[model samples]
Target: MAQVEMNRSVQTRPWFRQITPAQWQALLASSLGWMLDAMDVMLYSMVLVYLMSDLHMDKSMGGFLATLTLLSSALGGLIFGILADKFGRTRSLMISIIVYSVFTALCGFSQTVTQLAILRTFLGLGMGGEWVAGAALITESWPAEHRGKAMGIVQGSWAIGYALAAVVSGLLIPLFGWRGVFFFGIVPALVTFLIRKGTKEPEIWEARKNTRSDTEKEGSVIKIFDRKVVRWTILGSALSICAQFGYWGLFTWIPSYLATSVSQGGAGLSIVKQTGWIVIMQVGAWLGYVAFGLLADKIGRKATFILFFGLAAILVPFYGFTHDATRLLLLGPLVAFFGSGYFSGFGAVLAELFPTSIRATGQGFCYNFGRALAATAPFIVGTLAKSMGLGAAFSITAISFGIAAILVILFLPETKGRELT
Candidate 1:
């Protein structure tokens, strides 16, 4: 009877109490992988203006290249998702890091638009793969109770990477030119070594590997869309599309929106001011990521996402109408808080929902497919900006948040405290 009581007590404890040191280490490694991944991708956005001028490309062509990157990212996500499930999350992550870093540096050597476009496409492929593997790695390693916080920390790495890119651009773009900026991009490949040395396959995945039959061991990508999982696949894809469209559409153009001359309806801030604002805004984004994780953990993923999205829908439009620098300084954080915060939920929620057999594949498909849909954001916003104004172009972004909020409230189920198989 005493032994039975002890067993019951163990089973009744919250999931957070179950985490081990090894799981924490896995989370850190995956977070760093994701952080560096963002650094590589954000570098392109930061230096895109200069790259366009240097390559003699127009806005339309620039938009086209961004679109190409997104499309290729979709392909990469699908391919790597399969590989990650078939191979191992750690191996897939290392390969992706190497691929993106090499091609990102190669971008520095490009003399023509064609060359840059090719490099960006390859970079997108690697970029798409990294998140899928990293998210799966962290999800499978950590306990369900703390998974939201872990994923939040992992997602928060994006802001660090984005902040780093801004700093690098502000420091290097003036001295070494954009080419030098691309040169620095290659440094992220060093992260692969840490991953290769320190990380191991999660025990869950190891057990799954050992238990699998010959057919199951094959781990085909087609399994992700099996009847049981297809609804989740579609839901994740839709949510990702909404989030990415709003983010890339509004934030990608914001620096230009702020720095352009008044004739273009911009604030005409100097590069120094632009960089300062950009970096500062990301600080809010970082906080939002952390906060969203905690909130999702406490309340529920669905509830927290709805709250953030609702706030975003209200705040984003207001962000456009205001012109006071001091007001913007105060409001920028809030904008980032709502615009970027909910992303943290994806890693935790998606990881919990999918089975280990197709976890990475599901993550990649949902995320990269959303990116592909979002690839149109720049183009759509650019066309709107050309006709109406930057302020009005941003209004469209608010609609995306509304859509996401509704979908989360209506469609996505709460995943907090759920065990990942």
Candidate 2:
């Protein structure tokens, strides 16, 4: 009875109290990086239709540009992961911020799809690295027990970043057009500089590197593929691939889908309403992210993944096929919640899968590698949309989520309370 009461009380206690000051600061730093990265990357998605008209491009071409960004990000994350493992996570994080920010601003000046594509590919480099650096930093700082929650909070920032883009686009697009949205991407660079001056490297990482010889500290991409780490890497990559493909396939077109006229296979809503709906749906997403962390910390990682993946599988199709604005408004949040929330678990689960020696490298490869493969999703969805309609195009995401659920159940182990070695 005493133990039961103790467990109940602990459950009732707020999760934030368990985190340390330094951990909190690390969370703040990483969350800001992710949030800003989301703002920069999604800015393009928010304005893609306007861009299509201005650049005289089709959905497939726009999706291809998005694909280029994802593809380049794979290399960027892999490279930066090596650098983070070798040099430091904080430094890599800052440099990534600068790279993405500068190029995102440059995207505002693009005259053609070719120009935008080039600038976006360059921006993808920094954009991918931001997650690698930030996730590594936060994962290394927080305790094992709190890792899931910490990652959830950090991943929750993606919604914040998405919301920031929506808010800024809603306000700015009317005044300065899509170009102004891209110009705002440059603002995060200043944030990177401040975080550079303010934060230090995780001591665990420092100790691990300090004990090793200069030669020993060198990072190798091939090491993640060795016998010991390869299995987990494959599993993690599969999950990441499904999540990325499903997410981008559905969301890259949501704004346009919401705003497009009924004749062209959309809701025919105005830009303001579409932006408002997107923002509102993200509230559900934010709740999902928060809930995943808490529940993963409580129930266990495997169950959490299975639960959300299943929910996403069901909702993605419902969302895609539903046409009534009223019904969509109702289903949208639940769809966003389940579809986006499972992401909170990825960084924490992957961080625990490998030791410090190859942590960054493994994570970079797995997360971005899946992203690289998933790069084709947007293009595939776009091409399909030509004949099947946008709603039908998104049903493919349900299949991706279904695969992720199966992989999680069949192969992935529970890392709920496992300490990071």
**Among all windows of ten consecutive residues in candidate 2, which has the lowest summed lDDT?**
11-20
For residues 1-421, could you state the per-residue lDDT of candidate 2 as single tens digits? 9999987887577767766688788888899999999999999889988999999999899889999999999999999999999999999999999999999999999998888989999999998999999999999998788888888898889998998898899999999999998999999988876687677799889999889876774558888888998999999999999999999898888887887788888888888888888998888988899899999999999999999999999998888888888888889889989999999998899998988988999889999999999999999999999898898899999999999999999999988889888
User: Which candidate ranks first by TM-score, i.e. highest?
Assistant: 2
Model 1 ranges with Cα > 4 A deviation:
1-18, 217-219
| Candidate 1's TM-score | 0.94
Candidate 2 at 226: error in angstroms? 1.5
User: Best-fitting candidate, measured by lDDT?
Assistant: 2
Q: TM-score for all predictions?
A: 0.94, 0.96
Q: Distance from true position, residue 267, model 1, in Å?
A: 2.2
Q: Candidate 1: worst 10 consecutive residues by lDDT? A: 215-224
lDDT for residue 151 in candidate 1, whole number 0-100: 85
Candidate 1 clashes between residue pairs 3 or more apart in a chain or in different chains: none
RMSD, model 1, all Cα superposed? 2.4
